[model samples]
Target: MLRLKSLGIVSLICLVAACENSGANYQPVIDGPVGPNYDIDLAQCQSLAARQGAFDSTTGASAGTGALAAGGTTAVLNNKGTNVRDAAIVGAVAGIAAGAVQQQQNKAAIVRNCMRSRGYNVVG
Candidate 1:
């Protein structure tokens, strides 16, 4: 039994050592730019760009309309010699919100591109 135990211990040590050194001599195949086994479609990028453009245009127009309305209200308040600050504040808030939306849309486009580069099908 003692001899068998010694032999088992020796075998375990050899196995551990072999595993440790096995990976040292391994060389990975490196592909540049177009990686191995990765496929990306250019149409995905085009679609993303188009969607982003549409979102920007729509949001921008809405924000402009909102600002115009606020300006009109401010003008009426000024003519009546009442508080016009609130109208200006509301206009600023609406403009900021629209800007934030546009920023988010731009970020989404970047994320879509990244996902496509990572071999994912992005729809939007």
Candidate 2:
């Protein structure tokens, strides 16, 4: 069980680390003509967003929490031949998915907000 849990955590970490920050593709709707430094500013903001979105803290936290919760619940409900490891893995996967989605949203928002702060007039 310990080995299985450790393997799940390692896999989750690897997946999170390999995820690409979607902020690089953010194309905000500019209300008017862009400044001369628009491309540079956008690139900088995208880089910042990517760095910020590199690793979401909630991913590990939620994975651990979900694994424990699911394992405990499964053990309690299915006492006979209960596969707690499988349940834990499922829970961890779900947590990872949720965290990844939130991280992507955060990345996009970061890009958008950073552009707006730099006077880009992001209408979208």
Candidate 3:
């Protein structure tokens, strides 16, 4: 049982990390004009995207917290055979999904805002 609990915790951490690190790739467009300065603007947008991704890493905090709560619950109900495994699997999946969704949302918003700030009308 102890080994199983350890495995479940490791699994949960991996899932949450994967979800938080996920992001969208978007190319910025120039709506107005930048002919000569296009390269500079593009580089700036790329930097902004990287910063945004770093800033958005916190999106998975909720997922991690949820996983911790689930772990606690599993520890409590771990007396029966297979119950801990089943609960941990379900909890990890749900938390990962939630975190992934939030991460994607943050990535898109960042791209859109960054492009817009650069005088580009970004389209999905």
- Top lDDT hit: 2
Model 2 TM-score, 2 decimals: 0.72
Point out where model 3 deviates above 4 Å. Answer: 1-24, 29-34, 53-61, 64-81
Best by TM-score: 2
TM-score of each: 0.39, 0.72, 0.51
What would the per-residue lDDT of candidate 2 be over residues 69-117, giving only the tens digit for each residue? Answer: 8888998988544488789787877677678877877888888999999
Which model, 1 or 2, shows the larger lDDT? 2
From the highest lDDT down, the ranking of the candidates is 2, 3, 1
Q: Candidate 1 regions off by >4 Å?
A: 1-68
Write model 3 residue lDDT over 8-111, tens digit each, in one string: 66875676556543443545554555567656665665555555432245545655666567766987867553675556555655665565566656765676
> What digit string (tens of lDDT, one per residue) describes model 1 on residues 1-124?
4454456446544544444322222222223454443333333443444343323445556656666678678787574422343454456446645554554456455645655666655554
Against the true structure, what is every candidate's RMSD? Answer: 26.0, 3.6, 5.3
Instruction: Give the count of colliding residue pairs in each prediction.
Output: 0, 0, 0
- Give model 1's clash tally: 0
Q: List the lowest-lDDT window of 10 residues for candidate 2.
A: 16-25
How far residue 12's Cα lies from its native spot in candidate 2, in Å, is 6.1
The ten-residue window of minimal lDDT in model 3 covers 50-59
